[model samples]
Target: MPSLPKPRLRRPARGRGSAVAHAPEPETPNVEVVEHDGLRWVNIVQPRQVDRAWLEEHFAFHPLDYEDVFSRNQRPKVDEYEDYLFVVLHFPAFDKQVGRLNAAEVDVFVGPDFVITLPNQPIQPLEYLFTQAQQRDDVRASLFGKGAGYLLYKIVDDCVDASFPMLRKIGNKLERLEEDIFEGRSGEIVRDLSNAKQEIINFRKIVRPQRSALADLERTKRYIPDDLDIYFDDINDASERIWDMLENFKEVVEGLESTNESVLSHQLNDVLRVLTAFSAVMLPLTFVASIFGMNVHVPGQDSITAFWIVIAFMVGLLGGMFYLFRRRGWL
Candidate 1:
């Protein structure tokens, strides 16, 4: 087997008198090279804004790629430059107390010799990958140098895979809510379900564009090497799966919402029915009492037994009305 050539170590640029003159503006950290298993990787962490002069002096990244690093809140997508490929992806994290998905953006630059990752917000998956890379030399080599393209694959794959745990947590919550809805305690459950739906909707908003972006990348032949195409396919497939899960979750939530509304409506109808029945039974009694209380002379008002007669008639009327209502199932 042929031996891999040793990777050249490039020192950071310094000013005259070797007094490490920090660039007036912060420079994106230079790539850190790690080698193992005959592969080399140059990992670039969060990239900061670089002046044109600094870019010219320090590295050979395309000006447009540098422009993308400074671009604010870019949608997930891919761009092919003459010398490298640019990709943007979002990863999901949980806001535990709020119970929502917080997506973080990661912009990547992959070239023949280097891989640069820029994250606008805290992304858990990439941090996990970095930790793993630190622990495993072989994994570090596979990510850093065997192919810069492979590093892009690892980062994206890890991001996509991290979504599963979040999705599972949402699924379990949905299940618990489903039980609550069935148990006739849907007020709190419905509200929580609504929050979950919103989170899923937000997640879909973030992931759907990435799906199209990955699909676009898959079709392009300019930037992705033929051998690396499979990795992009994996990313696309993962995007599709995430989208499908979100869609299913949306449908479930809509169904649960409908069910919650139905239950509330039914309970309200029952209350209204009971009130109507009570009013029906009381109507005749009220009419009889009103007639007896009037000052005008009436046959019932003339006799001492009239009061007893009215009372007996009222009782009989109320009983009959109740019986009729029960027979008709209106009560």
Candidate 2:
């Protein structure tokens, strides 16, 4: 069987000062560079102001783009410029404090000879891709051989693809909650559903705008050269697939929530019906006792047998009312 053709990254001229072939040389402890076939992949795990200054010194990125590198809350977007393309994209990172998935921003600068990744927080797939490029020569040859546009494709594509497992998790949770609903675990299921719903909402927020941003990425000028839309198109399709799953999950959770509410309401009604029937039975018995306790002369009030008679009457009335309730299926 034939292997699939890898998308192309523009191969710049192997100019003077290019790093040795297949070596992932580090510019600093935090900044790592992988050079192959005249392309450089510079990855900074979390960029600081000093790193920002280094970038300004090394590259001619616009000041606004530099500011964007430090901004964690920038929405998914793409800014095309004459010299480079500045892209902002979000991927999911589970926050332990919030107990759900949240968007993590990855800011990218793609140029003719280099692709720089600045993630505001750690993303596993991004880290893995960079690590593989660092440790493996074949990995570098295949990835960095493509120009900056194609490298950008790889980063966004991997990050977008990573979301599928998370989607499956959300789907699995919804499935489990559906089963637990029937097992009469309304309390626990309610909380689980809420968490799952929140995760889905967070995931939707990440993917919804990203779809358009990816489309915008495709239209932006090729930084390394022209012709890499196929790669970005693949990323867009993946984003759309994630959005589709979120839509289905939104519907499923809503349905489950409505079903849960109905189950709760039905259980409440059963308890209320029983209480109402018991209260109805107690009303007459209370009236008879009140009359007997009055200071005014009452029939047979002075008789010794009155006490036993009242007790017998009360028991009879209780049994009668209980039987009536059972007959009506209100018990």
Candidate 3:
């Protein structure tokens, strides 16, 4: 809730005979500032609160970097500048309306004294880190005491770590789906599997690109300290691991889908086979009964027991057809 000291542009001292007027400070509503140990962490939530004008006036970020802040759905990337590094990263967020996880972009400006984060939406990980930084002295010290680069790393690390719980939820769903598939209780299992697959795909789409960005960060070694390469390397490794897990889940989903289709096909074939056998046996009996019912029947029409005889013949014919059908494996 605390605010950072308002930044100002320095000017030459006025002459003794001169008078000066000061410009009113601009209003910043979407910006949240957390200051610790002479370090400033500024978080910008959305585009409407600040634009290119504010960004330029405050941090003087590159035109392209601040231009990207107004946009949405940016690809993950890292750009190194003379005094700072501009990094765009995506974090996973669950969209309850869509019933799937989606990627939210976070644009970071890492400088010597401050780290600024601009998110397309209210990102949970960033909010969580902000809260921790405010309440936990250890977290504040570790993040701010080190440097801006380390603080940036901590934010990114938390973002990456947040995916694990989502992934675990997906894993649990898949496990239940697998059990349902084997137990032949596939009611709604297909839909569940589909949902899980979509989440995995969305997660992969969101995260796979970030691995390259993280690797670039590690290789560039521009914003972070030299000793912090290991931390970035570890993050890159985690990205790879997460990607691999998603790929495996994708394969499992495909296999399960194939199996489900196969089972459904087999069951349909069995029903068709039974229907065909019944139709085959009934067709001849119906024909024979129609023939006997005709006014000018040729055989066994006048005998007192002729009705019984015809019924016996029809029964024998039905039995013979069914026997042949069964022998041929049609039923």
Candidate 4:
């Protein structure tokens, strides 16, 4: 088979300092679709490079949207331009072996006749959509013509669905960590909990803003078809649920940290108590030895029998101190 063409790199139309300009170095794949047969069936593949000038000549995408396409680390949001809808969505993937979350950035431009998607990395949702578009005859039939809105809705919906598995994995990991914390596995468990909490926080940061953006999209009266409003509402609901899940997870993590600290503090107090008891028992014994070791002629130092008497006296004195401390509940 012939090799596919290399993807083009396209610079934003605006200057480098522009708020929505594309990154100078393109690290994501650009996917574009051409509608045909009153159905929209477009092959989804990552272009090796994107040519902004070429896109300008061929597609009528707004300059700002194009800049968004090339921009690195664009915040999740929705911007409706005069002729197109621009949106950024986040899809998170958890790598079990690595114990981390990988968040992919997907940027989209929906025009009257075409749809363009740019991703910071290859994401599973787009791959699944592309594969289904090719292999499923029903999908192929509806995707091109009357079902463009439906197709867009399905893509966003699928992305939201994909997040659930990652969330569940995180939830499970947290549960295990909670068990470990309770079981007295302090050191490693605490570190892992910290890392997991950070990942969840970062994920929430990406998700919450997107939730607000979706809410705004739902409220606006615009070119979006009436039938598609429900789909957007579904997306809004899913985003809200994810937000809530993250918040709950954060609270659980905080509780785990606090519990871990309390356990550690208790252990430290136990150790200190043992040390203090030992020191108390030895204090009188040290005093007895110091008096006998005096260089001047002392009452107990003159005879051989005096050493035995001193040893007996030291033992009795240590015994008395132990009894007193025990009576005071200090031992």
Q: Indicate which candidate wins on lDDT.
A: 2
lDDT of all predictions: 0.73, 0.84, 0.82, 0.72
* Top candidate by TM-score: 3
Q: lDDT by residue for model 1 over 1-331, one digit each (tens)?
A: 1222344567787667876755565444444445544444444455554433443454567776667667776787888777767787767766677767766777776666656566765577787787778788776766765466666678778888888888888888788878898898966676787787898888887787778777877776653568888888987887888889989998988898899888888989999999988988888889989988888888967677988888888989988998999999998
Q: lDDT at 221 for candidate 3?
A: 69
TM-score, ranked from best to worst: 3, 2, 1, 4
TM-score of 1: 0.83
Query: Candidate 4 lDDT, tens digit per residue, 1-331?
Result: 1122475666547666668844466344353444455444333333334455545655566777777767776777888777767778777866667867766777766655555666666678777787777677776666655555556677778888788887887899889988997788876677888898888987887787778777876765444678778888998898889989999999988888888888888878878987998987787688778877878889856687988988888888888878987898876
Better TM-score candidate (1, 3): 3
Number of colliding residue pairs in each model: 4, 3, 0, 18
lDDT by residue for model 2 over 116-163, one digit each (tens)? 899988999999999999899998888887677777888888998999
> Candidate 4, overall lDDT?
0.72
lDDT of 3 at 20: 82
231, model 3: CA deviation in Å?
0.6
Candidate 3 lDDT by residue in tens digits, 109-218: 88888888988888898889998998898989988988887898889888888888888888888887888887876645778778777777888889888888988988
Q: Give per-model TM-scores.
A: 0.83, 0.83, 0.87, 0.80
Model 4, TM vs. native: 0.80
Q: Which ten residues in a row have the lowest lDDT in candidate 1?
A: 1-10
